[model samples]
Target: MTPLPVRIAGTGVHLPPDVVTNRRLAETLDTSDEWIVNRTGIRERRWLAPDLATSDMCVAAAHPALAAAGCAVRDVDAIVVATYTYDQPLPSTALIVKEALGAFRALTFDITQAACANGVQALFLGSLLVRTGAARRVLVIAADSASRVTDPEDRTTRVFFGDAAGAAVLTGATTPGTGLLGWDFGAELSYDVEIPAGGSRQPAGATTFADRRHYLKMNGRTVWDTATRCLPDSVLNATAKAGLTVDDVAHFFLHQANLNIVRAAMDKLGVPRDRAPITVDRLGNTGSAGVFTVLHKGFSEGTVRPGDAFVVSAIGAGFQWGTLCFRA
Candidate 1:
């Protein structure tokens, strides 16, 4: 079936007020600011307050997006939230966002598999829903409090994660061929990045808590290698599907996973450095919120101009990854 056209009308991001500098981490851990910067290219990151949760940040981001889209809460037809951090396990964070935004009419759910790629995955799903006539307008949000799950004692993980939220409003394109062009998503069947426990398989227990199995875990080398190889391929595949090429993309909104990883992918795809805007240096890897956060920053800074064609790509836990192409 021919899919309907979809476009991103507006984008918004909310970062917690608390800033954690590499120096601050170094003060407690055995790592230094220089070491972290040289390794991850992250200088500082925002950590959410103990009192706040993922839904709070999602609501904070959603308001600006709806306003920017000239859309009201009542007008939204569906809400898709991408996050692994829910305040509780029962009611989905998407529903919480819908209630918080007072968008009682919207169908709400959550998507959690893509991990850091959740934002792009949500965008793809929202676009499909809008295109299929299942929804006229969709509010797609990705929020995460990675700090809450990060083990401070684990310097490797603690130094790289932070808290943030990002959102976008998607709807049918006013002009055809001016929105989403093509996308590709896939999982490579690996657990290179994951939280080992807390799910039904291991359910929370004393053993899990003592082992810190609930905290986020990663095989950094595996992720780096996998992303370096897969991200560029995904982008190329999606663009080719749309009858475009790497040179045709005006901007690149790749995941803010690591500075080196992004640089490697861009070099491999032959995308010049000037064409990609990165936010990981200051924001750290915000997990699912990273892609949209970078996109929102570009739009606000006027670096992403109207009629620009951009590619969004990410690799996350569950060995999941994807690429999305759009015309702004």
Candidate 2:
């Protein structure tokens, strides 16, 4: 008997055409390009038009991945869309993506309120389903339209976010450690410190709108500090579970949160700066799409190679954090 394998068939990414530079942002906010770049490593980011939505970018990314994998839309057995921003509350963004991609036969579902780490969480779940015979080819898409929740006057988040999507196709295989090797997940619910008002606790209405609770808010210093201390341990834990050392991995894909966080985590893990792949400088923080976008950029630029072991780790709201080890 052969053990089922979860192999990544293909990867794709999509960024909107609108590029919002820090210099451009400085025109309205009380901030400068140097300040934003020095802190976040973000020079610019993509933004969608007012008419465009999260599912639009997701479908765009998924189509290329499906084409690259030589699989038609019908070949997808499941579709998992990781997003905090949705086109609507009901029917799910997953169904919208499936319909747009023409995946008439796919089992589609949405994973919501997952910030930067949502992509990996979706991948982990999709991989398990494939390895367990629950599905065959699963399309995992991470997308965000954070501009909707952003307050243009608030320079902190306005300078850090952009709209984008990324996708990967996971399929059953016969090889061990071919795709996801191991995963580690942790959440500090004590710091559900960031939220916009669309919930039972604060339903959408005129009062909430007046309070501006529907816009993004954060304790940046707190989240950054927590991420620095937690991410390296998450990486180490995942590597240990997969029976590999940190030195054994070829490429490290950290979430594109900030330059300082990456440096701090690497210092803690004792991993060299040269091993990490980063794209926050040009793409900004793409919410859940950040990790996969960086990984895709690495692959395109020849930073990643075949048969090489790699690790991807992310920390964000739930206050969630997670890691996934893989063989490329």
Candidate 3:
């Protein structure tokens, strides 16, 4: 029997109200706004208040997404959250989001692999659930408050992350070939970027806090090189698998990791600059939420239209990367 085609029915996003401009960081840090902007193309980023958690952002994003899909919370059969910055370690953040949204019937879980690419990964899984008839409507949410884990004094990692959440509703597509075309995911398994401690391998302790081992650590150059090479290849492979070419794609939704890396991938794929919409300048890198946030903004602005061919791609800390092609 032929399975149903999965499509993204609706999308929504929530960026915290509190804005932190580059100039604001310059007030206490040794760096200036110009330095941060020139290096990262980030002028400002949103930071959630201490009181809010990842699940809060997820709920905020999910309501609008479900509404847009013409689906009620009770109609959803599954909930998948992609995040590394959960409010707690034991209970999955997806369960908390489910409770907040009152999605009582949904099977809830979290995807922690692929770090920043977890959004695309979750979307892929949601597609599978709907296509396989295991779910009727699946809510895929990606949220992060990287500011909570960032080392304030570490300018490199601190200037690049922000707090945000994005959600999408997936269901069976009525139009044939009007949903996901093809997708690919891969990992290079390098620790060039990682949080050194707080996990089971290196449990958190007083010394961990003293040494700042819990903060994110990154080798920017290594990431730039690996992502630049791997991302374009992933896109090409997925497009080929889908029997399409780069020229057929009308919009590109690459991850908002860094402007320079995005530009590099565009150049490699021979995609024109205007074809890809970027959000890193204003939102910073919202971890797994980056791609979904970009997608939501594009849809809201009418930049991504129906029947348009678009590709979404990302690479994260674990050297994980994924690319998916879709027809809107």
1 or 3, greater by lDDT: 3
- Error (Å) of candidate 1 at residue 170 is 0.4
Writing each residue's lDDT as its tens digit, candidate 1 over 1-328 gives: 2334787888899999999999999988999999999989999999999988999999999999898889999999999999978778887889888999999999997988779988888889899899889999999999889998889899979999989999999988877567788788878888768888989899999999999999988888998899999999999988887678999999889899988888999999987987878899999999999998888887767777767788888888988899998877
* Runs of candidate 1 exceeding 4 Å displacement: 1-4
Please list the residue runs of candidate 2 whose C-alpha ends up more than 4 Å from where it truly belongs after superposition: 1-4
Q: Give the CA lDDT, 0 to 100, for residue 114 in model 1.
A: 79
List the RMSD of every prediction in angstroms.
1.2, 2.0, 1.5
lDDT of 3: 0.90
Angstrom error at residue 54, model 3? 0.6
**Candidate lDDT values, in order:** 0.89, 0.84, 0.90
lDDT of 3 by residue, 157-216 (tens): 999999999999999888867888888889877888999999888899999989999999
Ranking by lDDT: 3, 1, 2
Scored by lDDT, model 1 comes in at 0.89
In model 1, the Cα lDDT at residue 275 comes to 81
Model 1 TM = 0.97
Mark the regions of model 3 whose C-alpha exceeds 4 Å error after superposition: 1-4
Residue pairs in candidate 3 whose N, alpha carbon or C atoms collide under 3 angstroms: 307-328
